[model samples]
Target: MKKAVTILFVLVFMCGGFMQAQVVKSISLNSGMVWSTQKFDYKDINYDLPNEYLTGFHIGFAVEFLQHEYFSILTEIGYTQKGFKLEVDITTPDFPEGGLGTMEIKYSYKYAYLSPMFKVRKEFRGFIPYVFIGPRLDYLLEYPTDEFSEESAKYFNDFIFGMTYGLGLEYMFGSFGVGLIFQNQYDFTLAYHHELEEGYDSGVDIKNNAFILDLGVKFYFGKE
Candidate 1:
């Protein structure tokens, strides 16, 4: 955790230094809802784990460094909420004939993220259409809590890495711009840390996936 925080600080410092040396085209504030899901891998477990999409939100600030009329590099830092819900039916030895009950669990998480994206835009008379692809680093700020089973509380990795790609349409009005953005992220690492039992491996393989829709406004610093 401390290491991740340190890295984030370093990135901010580096971005600030780079901005001072180059021309910063624009700065923006973004906030909107995030719809996220997860894919789980169970080794020896017999029952199926069904999860639904979880809704959350994110707020962030971004800096765009323009290299050409159509290309720019964008860096953003944000706080985001993401997670999923799990529903499963359990049958144990205590219930020889049938099952105990159905379990419905909600898992929630919060993270601080940094994303550096490459953006390509086409300018028109009234609006600009853009597409972006980036890699994001997420530092976990909260852990998962089980509503029913205390044993089910799993430890998540402190640092997560993901890829994000999106598209947006921005309406430019003088120095201000408003737009709608769509983004999707895919996590490459396991979502939880489960202690190994005799028959199971060290942990299960679970990855986080998210789709976000945001309405954002940008303030231009200088001439476009």
Candidate 2:
């Protein structure tokens, strides 16, 4: 992480002298779809289950460091919800006084994420194409179910971390700028849940990977 920060600093300095002024500044709003394609595994136990991938929406913003037309420093924050669905089938034993029974258990796990990005721009006469890459930090806000009998949930919220990279196009329109961008992130940490309850203390797990794609527009505050 220190090396990454040093590299980013070097790139920033190489763009221009310390006194170089910003040519543009902008704030963007985005809304797009995100998806995850992975399976869940119980971290501490052998309780096996089948789960399907999950999907949701993303929203965020971007800031530009306008030292050079083709170069800029950028940071963005976004929220994501992705997880898996589990389905289990069980057959009940036949009762002499009653009848046999079969049932299916279904549930899902969701994760929330916040990402900070560093972007580099490639300039043209009227259109600017840029690529961005950065490290992301995530926190879990909720669990799958409320089956725990304890007053406070015993499950620990896991941290999700990953890397991101993608491209975008920005158009110059005087003081205000307009653009569209797309990017994807993959988590490197496994997300799991531990049951501390006495009787139903079975462990649960979720997929470790996810992807996000976003489209946004930026409005520059200062003119070149």
Please list the C-alpha lDDT of all candidates, in the order they appear. Answer: 0.80, 0.59
Flag clash pairs in model 1.
Answer: none
Give per-residue lDDT, candidate 1, residue 45.
Answer: 66
Deviation from native of the Cα of residue 224 in model 1, angstroms: 7.7
Give per-model TM-scores: 0.81, 0.63
**For residues 1-224, could you state the per-residue lDDT of candidate 2 as single tens digits?**
34434644554464334225544356677778766655546545775455555666667655555556556666555556665444444434555443344343333345444455667776688788888888876666555555434443454445667777788887877766666667767766655455445655555544455566666766666555
* Candidate 1, run of 10 with poorest lDDT: 145-154
* Superposed Cα deviation of residue 31, candidate 1 (Å): 0.7
lDDT of 1 by residue, 68-110 (tens): 8899999888888888877767767887555777876677888
Model 1 has an lDDT value of 0.80
